[model samples]
Target: MADTKTLAEIEQRIAILRDNLRELVEQAAGFSGAANEELTADRINEQQAELDELLKKRDAMTKS
Candidate 1:
């Protein structure tokens, strides 16, 4: 139902998604004491799921 995303839009989305994913990775790696032991396996799964879904959406947009 939505129109296709422009190349710039797709790229911007990818960059944003990548940044979010990088932050998650940093948290998972225990970058700060506040994040240490706070990101459990379940939390990681949820974060990864969100990223995965976004990637799928991005892929579909590019395919179209």
Candidate 2:
């Protein structure tokens, strides 16, 4: 069983990831440079994957 502290930390991490992902998406949309755009797109994908994992972790913690 996860303790309340651990659960809280997971929730906090989720929130931060969500915020970061949102910013990355917004930045990617406006990015114009070809090379920079590609880099930004890659970053967006990476952040999205991290967000998904954190969400799954949070769900599992709550369910247990």
Candidate 3:
């Protein structure tokens, strides 16, 4: 019950992060300047790292 709920929440967060990553990529493509590009790239890396961690957690939970 609780585990299921938590898993659902995590899944929801993962989906949102994926969407954010997509938008970030698009924004990076449209934007110019080294500073702006670096900022966007940093954000993308953060989101991707978070997404990867969440995926690993979800996988472990499912396996359990």
Predicted candidate 3 versus true structure: per-residue lDDT over 1-64, tens digit per residue: 2399889999999999999999999999999999999999999999999999999999989888
Task: Tell me which of candidates 1 and 3 scores higher on TM-score.
Answer: 3
Which number leads on TM-score? 3
Question: Against the true structure, whose lDDT is highest?
Answer: 3
* Tens-digit lDDT track of model 2 for 1-64: 7688988988888888889888988888888999989998888889889879878888888888
Per residue, candidate 1 scores C-alpha lDDT tens digits across 11-64 of: 676677677767767766765565454654456567567667767776776677
lDDT of prediction 3? 0.96
Candidate with the larger lDDT of 1 and 3? 3
Off by over 4 Å in 3: none
Off by more than 4 A, model 2:
none
Ranked by TM-score, the better of candidates 2 and 3 is 3
In candidate 1, which residue ranges exceed 4 Å CA deviation? 1-39
Q: Residue 61 error for model 1, in Å?
A: 0.5
Model 2, global lDDT: 0.86
TM-scores for all candidates? 0.47, 0.85, 0.96
lDDT of each: 0.65, 0.86, 0.96
Ranking by TM-score: 3, 2, 1
